[model samples]
Target chain A: MTSQFPSTDDVILGPGDDAAVVAAPDGRTVATTDLLVEGRHFRREWSTARDVGHRAVAQNYADVVAMGARPTGLLIGFAAPADLPLAWAEEFTAGVREECALAGGAVVGGDMVGSDTLTIAVTALGDLEGRAPVRRDGARAGDVVAYTGHLGLSAAGLALLERGVDGPADCLSEHRRPSPPYAAGPEAAVLGATAMLDISDGLVQDLGHICRASGVRVDLESDALRPEPALLEAVRVLGAPAGNAVAAARRLMAVGGEDHALAAVFPPETGLPEHWHAVGVVAEAPRGSEEVPEHPVTLDGDVVERGGWDHFRRE
Target chain B: MTSQFPSTDDVILGPGDDAAVVAAPDGRTVATTDLLVEGRHFRREWSTARDVGHRAVAQNYADVVAMGARPTGLLIGFAAPADLPLAWAEEFTAGVREECALAGGAVVGGDMVGSDTLTIAVTALGDLEGRAPVRRDGARAGDVVAYTGHLGLSAAGLALLERGVDGPADCLSEHRRPSPPYAAGPEAAVLGATAMLDISDGLVQDLGHICRASGVRVDLESDALRPEPALLEAVRVLGAPAGNAVAAARRLMAVGGEDHALAAVFPPETGLPEHWHAVGVVAEAPRGSEEVPEHPVTLDGDVVERGGWDHFRRE
Candidate 1:
C-alpha cells in the first residue's frame, strides 16, 4: 500500500519482547542508521522534541526509500539526562509514531537509556519487493537526471529563522520538520530508475556522489532550475533586493541541505514519471578524460565548487 | 558454518552506501536495540573503548540468540566529544569486529556523530532460519529449565574490581567482556525449548521474567546453584571471610548482572543439550490458584528475595 493513505500495519512483533521480528518476504532488507545529537543536529531553542523526532525518522526513512524499498519498521535508541521532562519524551514519541504512520512504518522496538545529552539513534528497515536496489553506482552515461519534492523552501526557512523575520509558513516549517518525498522513491524504482539517492547534503553535493560512484558527469539545465512562486515570495518577504530572488533559489538548490528530496537517473528513453521534472543529463568522459573528472557536477557549462553549509546557510 | 571459529563473511553492504542491504532468506528478521551511556553503563577509567564495544555488541547479540535466531548483522551509532582521541575509536571498532566474528555477525552499517557525552547505541539483527521463535510465554507447567555458560563470574569480578583486588583471569575477563552462550540458543531451539531468555539481570530475576510470562512458577534446585570454584576463588581473593566465600558466590548467582548466559525451558521429555545443566523445574499454580503467584521463583523450596546487584556487587 502507498503511504499517501493509511495501510495495514506491518509489525510482526512489538516492544516487550527480547527482540522484534519484521516480515521480509523479499528475502532481503534495506537498512540504514542515523544518529542525531542535540546541539549539533537540532537546538531545543529552535525545535520541539516532536520536531526533532520527526526530523530523525524522516531522514532515515528517506534513505531506505531512496534505495527503492518500502519502509516497514523503525527502532529507536533514545537517551537524555535524568532531569528531562517526561512530557518532552512523550511528545517526542508521539512525533515518532506520527512520522512512522505517514511513512507506513511500524514503531516495532527501541532502547531507552539515561545520559547527560539528549541523543537519538534510529535504525530503519525496508522491504524491496524482489526488485534490484537502485544503487548510487548504477547511473550511466546519457541518463537523464530528475528530482521530485520541494527544493528551496527549507533553505529559505532556515534563513528566515536566523534573521528573525517572517516568511511563508511553508518556508519556516520545512526547516523545522522535513517532509520528504516518500512516494517518489518506489515510483522511480518501478519506472526503471538507473540510479537514485536521497538529497540530504544539498542537491549538487549529493548528486556529485552519484556522479563519482557512476563515473559520469552530470550537467544541469539552468533554464529548468527556476525558483517556484513560494520560494520567490519568501525571498521577497525576507527583504531581499529586487532581482536577487532567482540567485537565492539557485544557491538553495545548489548547496543548502536537509530537504530530504529524492533524486534519480533514468535511461533517456524511459518515460519520466508525472511528478519528476527533468533538470539534468548525465555525460560520459570526453575522449581524453581521466578516470574521475575533476568536476563531475555542473550548472549549465560551468563548474560548481563544493563548499560547507556557510555558503548559503544562516547558522 | 559455526562461530566456534572462523567462517564466511556476512557483509552485504558497508557504511559507504546510503543504506545497507542484508540477506533475509528466512523471510523474517529478528531485531533488537541497546543503548549504552558513559557513566551509567561503563566508565572509561574502568573499561577500554574495546571493552565497551565488546560489552555493547555481546548484550544485543545475546538478545537475538535468546529468541532462537542466528546473529547476522550489526549497526552502531557512535557519538563522542570532538576532542576524544582517534585511537579510542579504532580500538573500539576492533573490539566490535572481534565480537562480531565470534558471534557470526557482520558490521553492516553505522552512523557516526558528535555529542558532548560518549554514547554507543547498537541495533543487531538475526535470521531465524525458518524456525519459530522460542518466546518467553511458551513454557508449559511441566517443562524443565536448564542453563549453560558461566553465571557468577561477572558479578564476582565486579566485586573484586571495586575492592582493587585480583581474581581468576576468567573471572575478571568475564566482567570486562561478556562471552555469551551463542551456540546454546539455536541448539536449545532444536532441542525443543519452550521458553527462553538471556540472563542479563542475574539468574533468579531473569528466570522470574519467564515465570511471569508463562504463568508458571519455577523452583530452582539449590544443589545445581552451588558456587563454582572460580566464583569462590573470586570471593576469597576479594578477602571474604572463610565461610562467607560460599555465601558470596551464592549471592552473585542470585543478584549479579551482565553475565549474558542462556536460560531455557524445555519439554519434560527432551534431552538436555551437551553443555546445559538442568537447574530448575516449572510448576503450574495449584488448583484454583490466581493467574500469577505471589512468589513465582524459589530456590530449594525457599522464596529468594530479588534484590539489586548491589547486594552482591561493589558498583
Candidate 2:
C-alpha cells in the first residue's frame, strides 16, 4: 500500500510486496502500537483530516522516541466508512507523511480496511542506536524528575474545544496537532537518564507509573509546577476545570492528557538537556513508615488523586 | 500493555515502558500489517473471540514469512465497544499469544482502546536471518511456480458458513484458525526460491501481482491443479462457487481468500522442500503482444478474470 511513496534510504525493501524490510542496523528494534478511534480519540468536527492524522502519528512516534530510539518506519492500519471523501484520506496520509519525515522515518507499509466507524492503528518502529533502553524500573532513590515540553496545553485545548470557546490559539492548535519533543528522547538517553516516558496521561498519573515501577515516590515541587499562562487562561474560560481558577489550573496541569511531553529521571547532580526543567525528586518511602504512600505521586506534602481520560469507561 | 506476558528470549525489553525492544539480529526487520474489522473480516456469530484473534495473527504472520524471515514479535491494536465481555478480551489475547508462538514469536506489545466497532490491527515483525528478501520482482522466466498449503479450504469454509450448511470440518476450522506453512518460508529462500508471497487475496490475483512486478507470465498446468476433494464437496453443497461443480471447484481454487498458502517461484530443476508442489511455469509474454495481459494469471492458456475480497470497496 505504500508503493506510491518514494523509497527512503533506511528502507531496504519498500511496500508493494508481501512485507517491507527496514534497516535495523543496531540489531534491535524498538516497537510500539497505538490506536486512535473516531469520536473517542478525535472528532472530525474538532480536527481537520490532516490534524487527525498528525495527532495519530505524533502519539505513536512519542512512544518510540521515549524508548531512546531513532524512528525507522511505521506500519499503519486505517479503517473507515466507505462514504468518507477521498480528499480526507489524502489529507490524512499527507499529514502522516509530513510528520514521519520530521521524525526521520518513512511510511513503510499499511493496511486499509472498511468499517462502520473510522479507526487508525499505528505501529511505530525505531532503531535504538546501540544504547541501553531507559526503563521505568531503573530510577534510583535520589534521582531528580524532570520534564521537557508543555504539561497541560492539550488538556487546556480540550477544555476550550469542549466549551466551543476560542481562547489561546497555542492550546487549540496543540490539541488538534500535537508537536512532540522527538529529539529529547535520545538526548536524555545520552545524558544518563535513569527512567523516562512520554507524558500522555498527564504528569501526575504518568509520574506515578515511574514511581510504582521503580519502587520509589515522586514528590513534585508545587512552586515549580506553577500553571502555564495559557493553561491558566483556558481554565478561567472553562470555569469548571476544578470549580475555581487556581485549583483548575493546578488540576489541569496535573491530570490533563495527550501533551506527549518527555518526563524523565536523572541521577542526582546530573546535568539535563537544556529544555528540560526539574519538576520533582525521586525518593524512597519514608523509612519505617508503617505502609507505602497511598499515591506514588505527591505535590508538596499532599497526595494527588488520580484523574485522567478513561478510554473504555467513556464508552 | 504487554507487561503481563512472561518475557521471551527474543525480547530485550518487555512491554510496560512506552515501547518494546525486540531482537532483530540480522540488521534488518521485515514488517507487515493486517486489519480485521467486525462484519467485514469476521462475524462474531460464526467465530469465537479466539478464532478472530487466530485469523488476524495468521494473516500478518504469513506476510512476514513470505519475506523469507523468521517471526520475532507482534504489536497488536484492539478496539471494541465498552459492553464487550472481559472474558472475550482475555480469550482473544490468549489466542494471539498461542498463534504467535506457532511462528516462534511473542506478543511483544499492544494497545487497547474503546470504539463503537470491534477492530483489530496486527503488525508482525520478523528477522530475515541475513538472507535477501524473496521479492516478487525476482522471478525468472524459467522458474516453476509452487505452493505449500491448501489453496481453497478457507474460501470453501466461508461458502459453507454463509449458507449454514454442514460440510468439511477441516475447512470450517481452517477458516477460523489457519495453520500456515511457516517453515516453508526460510526453507524456500535456502532452496534458492526467487520470488514468493502468501496467497491472502487469492492465487490468481496474488500471482498477478508477481507477474506485473517481475514482468513475466505464469502459465499453469491444468492437471497440476486438480480440485481438492473437500473443496469439491463443499462446492457441490453450495452450488454458488460457480454455475457448475467442476467450474466451481476451479474457481474456488483460483479466487479463494484467506487460505494464506505460500506460493513461490523456484529455478527450474531446483529440488523443492518436502510437501511443495509445482503447479505452473513462469514465461515471457508472446512476441509482439500489443499489450500486457488484462489479467496476469492464466489457466490452460486462458485468462481468469479477477475475483478477491476487497477491503474498502465493500463499503
User: TM-score, each model?
Assistant: 0.94, 0.94
Could you say which candidate leads in DockQ? 2
- Summarize candidate 1's per-residue lDDT along B1-315 as a digit string, tens digits: 012223234445555667888888888889899899898988887789889879989999999999999998888888989998988888888788789888988878888888999999899998888898888888888889888888888887777777777679788889889999998888888889999999998888888888788888888886787677998888777666777777767777866788899889999999886788888899986542257677778888888886533554434
Runs of candidate 1 with Cα error greater than 4 angstroms are: A1-9, A237-239, A286-290, A306-315, B1-10, B286-290, B308-315
Model 1, A104: alpha-carbon shift in Å? 0.4
Please provide, for model 1 over A1-315, each residue's C-alpha lDDT reduced to its tens digit, 9 standing for 90 to 100. 111223245667667678888888888888888899988998887888889878989999999999999998888888988999988888787778789888888877888888999999999999988888889888888899999887878887887777778888887778888898888888899999999999888888899888888888899976787677877788777655678767766767776688898889999998986778888999985642347577788888788775522444444
DockQ of all predictions against the true structure, Cα-based: 0.84, 0.85
Would candidate 1 be rated incorrect, acceptable, medium or high by CAPRI criteria? Answer: high
Expressed as tens digits, the lDDT of each residue in B1-315 for candidate 2 is: 365455578898877789999999989999999889999999989999989878888999999999899988888898999999988888888788778777788888899999999999999999999999999988878899998888888988887787678888878987888888998999899999999999988888888888888888888876777777887777766654344666667677777868889999999999876689898999885542233476767888888766522210212
* Fraction of true interface contacts that also occur in model 1: 0.89
Tell me the alpha-carbon RMSD of every candidate: 3.7, 4.0
Worst 10 residues of 2 chain B by lDDT: B306-315
- Candidate 2 global Cα RMSD: 4.0
Kindly report the interface RMSD of candidate 2, rounded to 1 decimal: 0.6
